[model samples]
Target: MRRILIVGAGQAGLQLALGLQAQDYDVTVMSNRTADEIRGGRVMSTQCMFDQALQHERDTQINFWESQAPRVQGLGVSVAAPDGSRAIDWLGHLDHYAQSVDQRLKMAGWLETFAQRGGQLVVHGAAVSDLDFFARTYDLVLVAAGKGELVSMFARDAERSPYDAPQRALAVAYVHGLGPRPEHPDTEAVRCNLVPGVGELFVIPCLTTSGRCDTLFWEGVPGGPLDVFRDIKDPAEHLATTLELMEKFLPWEYARATKVELTDAGGTLAGRYAPTVRKPVGRLPGGGAVLGVADVVVANDPITGQGSNSASKCAAAYLAAILEHGDRPFDEAWMQATFDRYWETARHVTTWTNAMLAPPPEHVVNMLGAAGELQPVADRFANGFNNPADFEEWFYDPAKTEAYLASVTG
Candidate 1:
């Protein structure tokens, strides 16, 4: 059995470790935190997994929270006017529901499951110096840690990475007492409110360690009025600031969240990072190289909620490539080829996310306007969040969007 070592027990690392172990390959996973620590730690992200990504988990038998988590059946978008009034309001239905299980719950549960499956689980803070030693022992080493000094091991691919600075100053608070949407109380959906030149706010239903709750996420344009959470350390303060911001930019959502309070002391997180794509191969001290996976290689801004979904897809894609390689050596060529396969899917996500970070192009604005009047257009746009590849057909190009709109309207 060829030994494989995966560093970082995140969505990508754990998924790959488990998949390889299931195939009877020798696998070991290293994580900075233990399951207990993760369960008791601060919330990591607002990860909403769409239909196809959820199916990937089910196929791998890792869909532990599917039965308990809230189901997001569609998408609700409201673009706020300069005066804070709703300019365009629409709800797009999705054919299949998406789900968000807090990373604390999901990652902790997955760590336990990986160990139970006979895969080695090592809990420790791994750095570049550590990778030098690990590279000598394992047949292949994959670094999947999304952040920190470890990620610096891989050089940034300047041509592929579009941004040098952070796109949004992000703040997230998970809270209780968030009332349902008035129009669709029974159907849970990911609600997004866009305040052009200010920021975007997302209200996502999710299952946290404290049970079901809603996550209030802010993606503020840097130095803008919405960028107001730099000094907030208390969860209560975070919740309060969130409500205050909502009241200013998304009053409808603020009204719905009037009774909201933090779910727990650790339910809030605030930070920022540049959306980057790094070379998939990381060179060790002497001469050895390790492969990068998921966020470690392609970290995108959370504007589109594609991080976890992309991680899930990357895990499945890498698993297939590994299995197909059979007894072949895991060489530099193989590593590049594996990442190239995953990049085909990731490029779509990166492109879509980057498009969303900027001001809406005229065609996109037209599309949103049409969506308010056309149910099919709304539904297709809503479903596009699940399978972003569908976007390439009509989203990126103004001419294609115009042609599609004409065909549908006629």
Candidate 2:
């Protein structure tokens, strides 16, 4: 069996290991956190798992719903502006899929499957020194670490994807007692607002076992009326300010919200940006090479909620490449080819999504206003990430944008 070491224990690392292990690769995963530490916390962000990716999980017997996950119909997405709203309901029947899992539960589940198959797990602090040693010892080393100190070793200065410009800042928080929309309390959906020049805010629902749902969220385009109170020391005042801003700048539909309960204020309010870079391939200072996958290579802005979908697609491609090389000396050409295919497939989705979030270049803004036709275009781009067939069609067609615009306007 080909021996491989995957660094980072998050979704990408776990998925990659699971895929490779099915082919009997001697896979070992190394990470700093333990199952207990990971599971004890609420997931930090809201994410979605598409039906296609879930199907892959079931095929690999990594399906979590059969064991610990909740299978639900798709989710709803609402786009709101300062004056009002536009909702694209996804509440009806659809193929089976899962929403965000407790990060800890997700970690625990993947780790269990990985170990059961006889793949080794190493829990330890990581450094360049450790990665360097592994590069020499293993036939293949996969770096799946997302943004953090650990990812710096493989980082490079690539250009900003045309669809996206320089990155913007965002603040994410989790809140409780955020009483649901009075009309539809049972729905699991995400509410988004293009708060004019202030960026966007995402309000998503996360269900807990106690029957109380937590509000998973994001505050984008910092430095506005909302930005003023972010560092405020008083919880009551901070929440009051948030509510006020919501009322003033968001649609009146959110005004019905009567209460806001806060929790885990002790947690962080970290920020992230776009226009990130990753090299085509990374080489260790001393000698060997490791393939950089997912966000480690290209970190897209989370505004579109495409991270997990992108990661899963990349994992699937990586698995195919490894399988084709079966038992041969690790083929460098095959690895690069696989990486290139993944990049080409992802480029448009990542670029267009980022472009929407970026302060629109002047020409783009004029074009959008001239047509009064940007929203539907933006919505289609966000929703299209999961359909591989559509993605393939999109990348091959240079005039897809013009075609889409003409169709929408017509």
Model 2, global lDDT = 0.61
186-289, model 2: which lDDT tens digit per residue? Answer: 65445555555676666655433333344434455655544564466654555565566666666443454445565554322444555565764667777777
Compose the digit string of candidate 1's lDDT tens values, residues 1-410.
98999999889998888889889999999999999999999999888999989988998888989999998899989999988788999999999999999999999999999999888998898989999998988889999898888888889999988899999999999998999999888999999899888899999999998889999999999999878888888788888888999998888899899898888899999999999999999999978899999999999999999999999999999999989998888888999999999999999999999899988999999999899999999999999888999999999899999999998989
Worst 10-residue lDDT window, candidate 2: 86-95
Clashing pairs in 2: 38-104, 39-104, 167-274
TM-score of predicted structure 2: 0.79
How many clashing pairs does model 1 include? Answer: 0
Pairs that collide, model 1? none
Question: Which ranges of candidate 1 are over 4 A from the true structure?
Answer: none
